[model samples]
Target: MPDPTPPGPRAAILPAPVFTDPRVTLFHGDAVELLRLLPGASVDALVSDPPYGLSFNGQAWDDAAGFRESIPHVDTTAMSAPEVFEVWCTEWAAGALRALKPGAHVAAFGGARTWHRMVRGLENAGFEIRDQIAWLHTTGMPKSMDLSHAIDKHHGVQRTDRIVQTSEHDGVLGATRTVLSKGTPVTEDAARWEGWGTALRPAFEPIIIARKPLAGSIVGNVLSHGVGGLNIDGGRFADDRWPTNVALDPGQADALDMLTGTWQEGSMSRRFPIFRFEHKPAARERPRAYGVSHTTVKPLALMRWLVTLVAPVGGVVLEPFAGSGTTVEAAAGAGYQVIAIEKNADYLPLIRSRMEQ
Candidate 1:
């Protein structure tokens, strides 16, 4: 049997500062190692997108390295296996829990396939499980392999190499070329799953909202430590609608009809209207000038709202898995003091450029 202990610090924990300012601080190293140096009960809120144990990045899958849109900069080393990844998460959560004040909230992003393991790990680390917020989007690409296509290729059915779809004119074809799929079809020996897909179309990502157990009642806790309440009014939607757990992808609002004022909830529903929103694209000049942003980078609008939802005005925020410093950018833009740490040094320059811009 494998030993069930979390790994110790990967390197020596240092107190030296990487980059520091009045509004923002940046660190490039192992998150758990860096987190161990911070004092307990220091940060007001925690928001981050940690490794979900899915080996989707370049280093894990050799067939997917160096793609233009793939995570060329991120080489995920913490996710060797699910159990090991869970231990990694638990270690960081323990550090984050110690760093957070009592009654503070944490909003963490997790992948759909590994969300259950992440939640269990966090709960074990002393966080009270509150809710799972889903961010829905329509931009997911399905990577399921077509079984029928593979079966045909196995039966000596060679796919069309290259062909010109152009019409022959005067017994001569044009000098241009256009290729089309040409493969044998599986008929009598077709399996039941021949036409069926292996996976569902991707849609939403789950964000777990959790909190540290308070030392006292809600009001008492807030009065004592200035933490423990959600900023509902400050983060509400327009037309008197309360904040909801659902958010939409960019340009998704146009497809929605005008929501009426008369929203009657069921007995089990929260007694207010739920609302969703679309994030407008950031100004083109910034991304164009700096090159495309991080592949999994959260939109600025969504990050801004999420930071405000948990962290109080002028409160200090901590993001341990800070990829490209999106959370740091959001915090600084919202006038909150933030500390951002990323394991990948490749993204440090990009974060600096984006934050400075």
Candidate 2:
């Protein structure tokens, strides 16, 4: 085999002003190196949405001689998919477990393709798989498909008030866009018209919640609750029916608002601002022009939900691949100590700006 490669440098070695802050320790360097510096079992929770190993945004390799004049020296493409993922999961899981207090939990976010691999890596790092929770979102981008138009009239004239039946297409296409009014039809066509529905939008992804098992004996079977589904005791005969897919109505919004401590518009008005920020689009103009480091950045709502679940009230949370500091912001919002490590220096300022705001 070739000579073993040297490990990346730790992010903790940066200026004192960077890592000294306990509230939010934002390290602008390689996570693998930074994680090595942290004491084992030092965190209350290890929550991160690592790169999917797909080399998203093409940051895996550098083509500096091409259109782009310069590139970040650190290229992740040197390692194979399995090697990269294994290193990522193992390093963080080991450090996280070492950092956590006994019986603490870790919720890692990953795509379907590498979710199992991550779970396996965590298991190897000595973490027990607890529950695989689905972090479902209420909003997503639209998908396009080719719709075969059945021309009912051969007169080459568009029929007035004619029904255009469209089935789901795999490819993107611009057609009669869907629009929906409140309490209107929930059909595919209606959803299309209203720009609602995953068929027309991007598919919702799930988050895996795996816990580091407590050392003691079984404590009467731990009880757990599902956010979107039914309630039951540990020994009850529960049928695994498909989870009830309830849209966020006024009542659900009110309940969630209370749970998440969202500010109410008014005492009488039941509407909560939880979804308001959740649904807010990216800034029309970015603060600075930087190449896309990662696509499908995790929303703050999803990160906050995970942080609240796995981390203790004031415990430290570690994100190995702290892209854009979504986890950092969420952890700060939830009042937990956070240490975010990102290798890309260009995104460091962006993360700082967002967190400082």
Candidate 3:
């Protein structure tokens, strides 16, 4: 890979490209800055998994409280976390709007709790709201707290029917266990909410698809800009089934099969309404030895499908939030011109390694 110095005119506002090859360019900096610096109407598509504003695992990058402080001219003191995140998204989405060519699309992943805020932000930034694609999975760990357990603890009552449940993961270092209550609730408040938890297990993540306004008609725009159209044939399933808005992992597909009573459509089976993706256990458990440790690494297969769906053949794909570089790796590996911007410098090495592969 070539670490070429940026041109003199852009060097003032832009840093040198960290890793630049014929197919890919990696930058180490804030996404907003890079998005602003990109040449207007130059990028063909935008696909990324930006921050979810959930402060996941206490990671500062995902924390909206501190992120709000960095948005210039925005007073976030009284704003809630989700509200602040909307402002942040609008800021970058505006930059993206300027950088993307007319009729290009943006495929962004968002948290379930704050997906509407992201959509609002995109709409606020002048992008036309398109359909939302659901990335269905069954692997999300529930973050709900047990109401009965909390009530019992607050009342100072010790339950004797607590049991430890352990599950070992493949390729993981050790087993993870949690305490479960099996005994009757000792307090009235505990008994009232004995079987209830705060939240349900997460089953799906929303992937928002927004598009820049077309210069003219869709056919005219595609002819002029080489974009503004989905690669449906490229994204088609086996037996020429057109891809649906729902993308499913193996677990989710299995669940849907159970619910609908079949998977593949045949003389003996019923057809389901899903586009099943290749299973990727490695997406959940990345190789720590390579220093690839982004907490929310997306499945490479899903990323590949997304990039192909939005971007035209051999066109430029911009990934503003290249966490773990899955989108970047997918875009580049699939033979598109890629520009990957990552805010956290710690993951740069992992991204470069992925590009080399």
Best model per TM-score = 3
Residues 245-291, model 2: lDDT tens digits: 22232344555667878746552132323322243224421223254
For residue 129, give model 3's deviation from the true position in Å: 0.8
Error of 1 at 291 (Å): 8.0
Model 3 per-residue lDDT tens digits across residues 1-357: 876976565354678899899988889987766788888899999999999888887877888865775585788889888889999999899999999999999999999998899999999999998899988887777888888878999999978877778876633324566676467788999999998998999878999999999999999999999999899999886557888898887667767676876545431122332266645446442524353467788877788889999999899999988877888888888999998888887788878777666
Ranking 1 against 2 by TM-score, winner = 1
Task: Give the per-residue Cα lDDT of candidate 2 at 244.
Answer: 27
TM values, all candidates? 0.76, 0.57, 0.88
- Which lDDT value does model 2 have at 347? 69
Best by lDDT: 3
Error of 3 at 348 (Å): 1.2
Q: Please rank every candidate by TM-score, starting with the best.
A: 3, 1, 2
The better-scoring model by lDDT among 2 and 3 is 3
Worst 10 residues of 1 by lDDT: 60-69
In model 2, state the lDDT of residue 169.
41
